[model samples]
Every structure is written in C-alpha cells, then in structure tokens.
Target: MKRLISTLMIFAFALALFGECALVFEKYTTDTRIKPITREMIAAQIRIEEKLSEQTTVNTGEPHKSTPSRQDNGAWMLTLVNDKNPLPDAYKPILKSLSNGLQFDRRAIEQLNSMLSDARAQGLSPVVCSA
Candidate 1:
C-alpha cells in the first residue's frame, strides 16, 4: 500500500509539473503528422546530412557508410520537415537545396522509411529524434 501511494504521488507530481498537455503528442499519428523522428530515421538522416556539403565531407564527424541507392530516374518523392511548423513546409527551399546540392532521387525517401521500420522492430518507437 505504501509503495502504491508513493508511485501515485510520483505520477501526480509529474503531471503537476509537465501537465496533461505534454501528452498531447500521444493522441496523433506520427507519420504525416506531429511527432518526433525515430532512431533508425535519425541514423538515415545523419547519413543524408553528410551528403549535403561536399566541402565538409572530409571533416564530417560520422563514418562513411553505405546508403540505399537513389532512384536512377529523375523522379523522387520527399517530405520536407520544418521543426517549427505543424504542417509540411513548402517546396521552395527544399527544392532549391535538392536542385543545387543533391540528387532528387526516390531512393532517399525509401531508405528513410526502411530505416525507420528497422528501428521500430529493434524496440524503438517512431518518435521524432529532435523532439
């Protein structure tokens, strides 16, 4: 009984501090919605971050690892994330960056999804990493 009371007190205290609103994310779909990035996705994203700057590739902090092959065709699909915004950000900056800095191939998006799934199976939830 004492342990139960203590646990209850801890829960109440946490609620008092963070409040119920902090749990708001639990109510929504993570994909195409409000949520944090996953670990596997984080891993994949880290790989992508490396590919962004050619000048810094030699100095990049991460190791060079094999990534999923990008789509050979010119077509690609992507979701540009804006941490500050709820809805998906527009295609201006993202498109321009891709056009100038990287290949707009379909493989990037597919690889991210694949990594995210692997992470989920490895006991990681699909919560956003930077969240």
Candidate 2:
C-alpha cells in the first residue's frame, strides 16, 4: 500500500509539472507575432518561381540574338528515360567523372557545377544522385 501511494504521488507530481509546461508553452506561442516558415514551404515557392521564370524572358539591354534551341545543341539531354521510356541499346553519352567520382554528361558538366555552386552559395546542400 505504501509503494502504491508513492507511485501515485510521483505520477501526480509529473502531471502537475506537465500541466505547468503546457501553460507556459501556450502563453509563449500566443505572445509571438511571427509565424514559422518551413523548408517545404520555401521549396514550394522556389518551384512556383521557376515555373513563372520559364514563361517569361528577361530584359537584357543588348539586342535579342536568335540562338539555337536546346534540342539543336544537345537532344540527348532532353531524352525521356524512365520505365515507360527506356533508352535504346545503341544510345551512349560522352560521360565525365566529377571530383567526388559521380559521372554526368560532359556537355552539361560546366552548367551542373555552376548550379551546384550557386545552390551552395544560397545555403542549400544539394545532392545529385544521378544526371
């Protein structure tokens, strides 16, 4: 009976402590005016901005020069390679190995490096699993 009473006393103490903590938390949250922005929310915003940028052309001061489309430069980069669209047996790309031993297409290595560096500059750790 004594052990039962002690356990009950401990549980009651813990319950009271928890109630105090909850009250403190409620007061702190209610007093705050700022809302938290999550990484997922920021990523969603980045995706929306990317879509909008793709549809609009930037105003560079120089006259517009017609450059060949990406397809004309490197059609292989645009190839759809998934379960539904498998690559042909004869298809072979000129690959280059990165410093960390990951391989990507030689044609896009410069652009990929630039993108990775840019992302790093903006405080994002990007991991490229595949090209």
Task: Indicate which candidate wins on TM-score.
Answer: 2
lDDT of 2: 0.84
Which tens-of-lDDT digit does each residue in 37-97 have in candidate 2?
Answer: 9999999999999989977968788986544333445566686566555665687889999
Error of 1 at 46 (Å): 37
- Write candidate 1's Cα lDDT for 1-131 as tens digits: 99999999999998876765555554453445655779999999888887776646575588655444544365434432344323323534232113224433344645655776899999997643331
* C-alpha TM-score for every candidate: 0.19, 0.39
**For all candidates, what are the clash counts?**
5, 0
Off by over 4 Å in 2: 1-74
Q: Best candidate per lDDT, number?
A: 2
CA lDDT, candidate 1, residue 80: 29
